[model samples]
Target chain A: MLAFRKVVEKMEGYVPGEQPQEKGFIKLNTNENPYPPPREVLKALQEKVTPERLALYPPPLSDQLRFKLSEVYGVPPDQIIVGNGSDELLNIIFRAFLGYRSRVAYLYPTYTLYRTLATIQEADYLEIPFQGEDFQQLPSRFLAEEADLKVVCNPNSPTGTFIPMEEIEKLLQSSRCPVVLDEAYVDFAEESALPLLPKYPHLIIVRTLSKSFSLAGLRIGFLFAHSEVVKGLLKLKDSYNVNILSQIAGVAALEGLNQVKENISKIKRTREWFSQALKSLGFQVLPSQANFVFVRSRSYESLEKVYQELKSRKILVRFFPEWKEWLRITIGKDQEMQILLENLKEILGKEWNQGA
Target chain B: MLAFRKVVEKMEGYVPGEQPQEKGFIKLNTNENPYPPPREVLKALQEKVTPERLALYPPPLSDQLRFKLSEVYGVPPDQIIVGNGSDELLNIIFRAFLGYRSRVAYLYPTYTLYRTLATIQEADYLEIPFQGEDFQQLPSRFLAEEADLKVVCNPNSPTGTFIPMEEIEKLLQSSRCPVVLDEAYVDFAEESALPLLPKYPHLIIVRTLSKSFSLAGLRIGFLFAHSEVVKGLLKLKDSYNVNILSQIAGVAALEGLNQVKENISKIKRTREWFSQALKSLGFQVLPSQANFVFVRSRSYESLEKVYQELKSRKILVRFFPEWKEWLRITIGKDQEMQILLENLKEILGKEWNQGA
Candidate 1:
């Protein structure tokens, strides 16, 4: 028999969504920003993230990127630790802060990856599904230390349900252990928990440059916590986790925050407009604080027909096999979203009046 | 006080060697190659590791890079796993294979990073120092399963010592646990354990592009193992551990293998010329199989004086505080080595030779 850890052997690994290559596809599968990143990104990479630096090892902590992120988030540089993606930050949190003997809790139908990360860390995993109060309030049984760590996906993934800040604060006040607030989609959310950094040392917020900055290609994600916890993550992180191109691009994106804001506004508008159009049909669209919206299929035939029609039209939307009925569509550019609606209308009904 | 894991709380983390950025300095501190990667690297970045791919999540196993590495090593893609660097690969091996309660061993004076990785993995750490005789012929005590895994830094770092392949085979036959041969600097070494990969299912050899391929700025490494172990690492790794740029450069470098061979030849030639010069100065130089030489200083003063003199003359080298009298110098371009020799000759006569 092969020599390997039982924990690793028994685990089914996490696989991310597909990036289909066929052109003319209105891709709304992965929740990526529809607009390009700040102008500074393309400009600087050709200049500063140049051939010479590519010959030497990049800075261990990526000092400049940390400083820029700290300035934007209003946190000290020492309290910031970055990763290849916000996913990597979450990996470090579970791997370093919590022991395998410790337990972790997250709501089901939230970011499903939390359970996968906890399992990989070999921790006791617990899930309190988003059943009662529409996932707004923490489960009553969870107020006590059911787990050593609790990960709350703010404006949670898949469902796009935005829980109020007060409930999170209340959970923090009574929770048995440290809490991680994953805000990967927070740029499109109503507000972020970054402002709460100073008040709560036990609260950790993870952010990514992927959605808002339009830089999913150059992997850059960061976690903000009490300096002590950040220090713990630093201790566990790979020395050269962030490459030079990313560090340079991250600094550029932060400096040109105006462009980032513009892009975010464009996406936010498209997201709202798309939500209204989806609801115009019989689909029940969840209130989303992310770049993507979750719509429940009214009729099983309609769901199957719409999915197949969109794919045939070279438009892609992610359908979860776990929750087979609901569809997750990323907010594409205005033109792309319009094409999706038109194609969707044709699939639902031939005429505009009959589309409902 | 923060409620972190007790393991990380008491841990004093490893500090990597300094990478200085002084103008006009001939940098031989870290063992980075002097040449830029072949032109194919830039071409691949522009043509393959694109902005579009970045927008979506990267392929988890990086099938393309794995396939390229497998072809180079004459193994199939299933038998390999890629990482941000061999450092991350080593971390995965410890977690997916060695339990925290299990013991792990390595050479004391070899890549000290192996011990650090093991400690971070919470494996019981064991080390056997480099004494006399060939590295392959470890002491009888090393074969015991008290250590669940052993890491052999082939053509070892700091002290460039090479062990015969037969000796490694002997250990695999005798030891109860798995053996990992870290070939991070193996391009500079005379031999590799890759040919024996087919026969030894327990062997896992880790390699990197940081040294010979001239892509230190791009942190990419690969692992070769039995398909079972490779799958195990994949299940345990962070999905996007290797970023877009590194993946692009890795394939190009693999395609340009002849260019890499030429680069390694130049480094080897320079290594020989410089080692002979050091030997003439009465320093005991280990016969290096890698692109660097580890020289023992007769005393702490000699080491300190040599280090200071090199610094003042705009030259840099790595000195281990733990092994205070040993200096590890990377083989630079022939002209850069000349600068180091001239600085060493003038300084040794002035300060290091004063007492002698």
Candidate 2:
């Protein structure tokens, strides 16, 4: 009865990190900010909700928001393009670049969404596995020389490991194809690929308001690339992909950068504290630059058991079956982290010091 | 320095109907509702604009908005899928259904966006010209036998003419392909293909809040299809295609259905009056089932010249280069219509009465 394209029929859609319906859970499965965005975001919505403003079509290219983003990011307005979310921008990039028999390469177990997008495009993909627990890119072996597009998720998801700027530069300089630095979590990292844009024309860096700006629900994402790359993506994107509310809220969020920086600093502080706490609980935690920490305990089965026990106690942290022993825990507020620690201690009993 | 897909590089992007930046003109070009959406839309935004609400990922599937849509449309919640707009839904449909070398069929000079979508998909398309000025579909020739996907725009754009339900049924019955009835303008039309859903599993009807609901800026559109079709689209769509504010505002808009109906009634009433006035003033007005009238004057050049004259006098209506002799005039408020009439009379002078 179904006549969808072969790829679509065979492929499972990208499953997002679960968002539990109940309110009592310490919701950390998704890497959403524990705090709210700047008051200006809310203020913008309140002031801009007039009948006249909501009646007309939004500026098609989001010119005002782009101009504001330009001022904040120090990139020319033409070099940036925004999307409903970075997901939409990724979809556009895939559509504009990948065709029949196109090859894409990214690190395995990075953002799983890349694999799903490649599958949807029917593109051949090379998932280069990271060398070790550090999730390091084996640049010489694959991405720099092969594939039509190379995706590097700086401060990669789940792992929360940040790849260095020099490594990204080497890939951009050596690669025949365009390289995308998905810096969705880079606001918490040491530096950004945005600084490398002027030197590397083929380098595209994507950032999201979902994390640093605390506007995940508002669905605002932007990419910085050469003007030609931006022009090509504009051709593929839905004209009104980003709505009027997102544009207004995004502008306000940018305008209140000081508030966002404070929130980021708080989250970073919380991340460091949470990592130490997890280590104290007999878990080996990776040094994380993003808002989340990746950890593995003494055994795979025990790690799996801890995830279930935490869920039963109304704590939601991410677990990957493929990784088996590892858990990606988003850093919530200090109180939420304390509750998580208490629950984990209760689940372990006195055996926590026995390292399994 | 550019490396883009051939289809993307060679094709010009879809240019949306001109949204004049400086907005003093009686803006009628895009068929936007002259009235506002329900007061509840604004009220919801004001109440829901908390820090916590805008910080998390939106409900990935938009379950709450879909539930409300289901209640209003009498469709099952499982059968509805909300999009950033119906535009995003169309993009998903194209991606899921079409592949390289796939063929698509649509009416000529319908929503111009469809052809652009087909180009982006790199699919071959057949543009079947409508029979005569009434823009009737030619069912027997090509659509059923040849194309993999069939698109029917009901209460079609520019012309504002609708294909009858029975005609649509006949086409759906005969076609082996999936048929999408884009009902973006259907709220003002006589009948909808919605009732045909149970009978034809391959049929999809797309609707938007942009026109009748006066929520153009908010970008909420949904499709009614078989649950399986929705499942396929869900796989192809970005996880959070619809943002949180649009979801909240859409739910509130649905709650205020009475206000939407009243606005629709006013536009329909104005459409009838305005069509008659144009007819009396030497323009051949097509029978409209939408909020706009498709008109033609004595000569193609004269019609073109009239558009320019109207623009010069701070009035705006859509002019299509391909449909050279025609103008799509959106029905505005009585006062705006009066101004349009006065300006047209002034531009044409006594010559307008002489049919030129």
**Which candidate leads in TM-score?**
2
Lowest lDDT 10-residue stretch of candidate 1 chain A:
A347-356
Q: Give the TM-score of candidate 2.
A: 0.97
User: In candidate 1, which residue ranges exceed 4 Å CA deviation?
Assistant: A21-24, A131-133, A301-313, A343-356, B46-51, B131-136, B144-147, B301-305, B352-356
Each model's TM-score?
0.93, 0.97
Q: Give the Cα lDDT of each candidate.
A: 0.79, 0.86
lDDT of 1 by residue, B241-267 (tens): 777667777899789889889999999
Q: What value does the lDDT take at residue A248 in candidate 2?
A: 90
TM (chain A), candidate 2 = 0.96
Judge candidate 2 at residue A140 and give its lDDT. Answer: 72
Can you write out model 2's per-residue Cα lDDT over A103-140, one digit (the tens) per residue? 89988778888988888888988988777767755547
Q: By lDDT, who's the top model here?
A: 2
DockQ of each: 0.57, 0.82
